[model samples]
Target: MPLAKDRNTLRRDGVQFSDPVAADTLIFAGALVCLDASGNAVPGATSTTLKARGVAQEQVDNTGGAAGDLSVESRRGVFQFANSTSTDQITRADIGSECYIVDDQTVAKTSATNTRSVAGVIRDVDSNGVWVEI
Candidate 1:
């Protein structure tokens, strides 16, 4: 007549131990929270503001879906506009093209116009033109 061995045991604090236990087993003592790069909780970061690193540029998309136009070039990075007090000023030279942050806005060119709106950050300004980050 041999005594039976207890295969599993429970500690006083609610931890469980068993025979032939795994070495790599992870035990969760309590709840865990996740955070973002800013060290803020991910869930609470929904409203977090992202600072723009460079100048602001408005995207101009053609509305008519035409294959060729200045607006198309603007959207494709060929041409970009700088922020102005009333409107976006187009410039070929990089002078006075300091990067600025701006909110999104929509503009109607015309009834048959095929231009759309886009927002992006400025990457660089040169004598040729200003580059935007889409």
Candidate 2:
């Protein structure tokens, strides 16, 4: 099928999102975040089952609440995070390659034997940290 005439399309910036936080989850502002198996926001960590969402926009404490009791605002874009050490460290050659979540603020070169989930692609690496296109 094809458009018969004119049509309107909805558009968005595609960089930000607001999703419900997982129960007993405490997401800190500026920390890397991910969605768990149930699609609830949680701090990014070395887990093979999590999907990297984005950086948490603000702190949201759901320690005393159930799932969906609160929401978290996250922004998706390129961000810098700490690089893993030793065998897990990211190097300049790893640019444009995929990285894994080491923690809320760190990424590694590999998935640590599938014990970690994909963080994002490496855009650049510097003395400070790895710039990830999440």
Candidate 3:
């Protein structure tokens, strides 16, 4: 047979118990925590402790510009877009000095006037290269 013991009898002022009991035995300990009036953590309270398990932060790229038809030239050259007509061209230098466009589809540049679009998500970046989820 098993019996329930009072919390005060099991634990003294600041002492805990360390004993083995039968598999079917059961013991109930007092509630672990006390709450504040505003439902916030209270100081100098030792009932329950909160800890952060894991944390993660992400960097998002949100460079916005007017969507236009563009073309790629050379092997590692920047991007160029047509203004109004196909004959009128706008170079990357015309946009901004620090503006850089990346081709999301193909890793290798094939043609001088290749017209294409890429659809994917940036996976990660490192010293070697960038990884894309395509």
Candidate 4:
């Protein structure tokens, strides 16, 4: 599946932090995350938790080994996360647009001129998913 007119490319998604932390369990890339009491990366839990810590950047489709090898395997620092958008908020996404944590693993757009803390920002989006600068 190659076209002569097209080539591989990389995009500047985020400015990575100097250090990385391990995921508390199996986590996919682009997952909104929070810090466990031990300061490890854990999957964020629901929109109302207000535990908007950071984003995850690990992706493992299948881990067919014993004892859940995926746990503590994905180590990532403060890097920007990119993934699907909340259907209710996709339309409001634009570059530099402020976004909110709508769920454990997604982001949404905030109402204009409202008072709320911003979770991240809309870096990019398309038919597949969203690119959040978190």
- What does candidate 2's lDDT look like per residue over 20-58, in tens digits? 999988999999999999999999988989999999989
- Order the numbered candidates by TM-score, best leading: 2, 4, 1, 3
Instruction: Provide the lowest-lDDT 10-residue window in model 4.
Output: 15-24
Q: Write the per-residue lDDT of candidate 1 for residues 39-108, one digit (tens) a residue.
A: 3211111122422112212222333432223111111222243333333443434243333323222111
Clashing pairs in 4: 29-58, 83-130
Error of 1 at 7 (Å): 40
Best by TM-score: 2
Model 4 error, position 111 (Å)? 8.1
Query: Cα RMSDs of all predictions?
Result: 23.6, 1.5, 28.0, 11.9
Q: Order the candidate numbers by lDDT, best to worst.
A: 2, 4, 1, 3
Residue pairs that clash (backbone atoms under 3 angstroms), model 2: none
Global lDDT of model 3: 0.22
- Tell me the deviation in Å of residue 95 in model 2: 0.3
lDDT (C-alpha) at residue 88 in model 4: 40
TM-score, candidate 2, is 0.93
Runs off by more than 4 Å, candidate 3: 1-114
lDDT digits (tens) for residues 15-52 of candidate 4: 33211234335446666655445544455543333434
Clash number for candidate 4: 2
Candidate 3 at residue 26, lDDT?
21
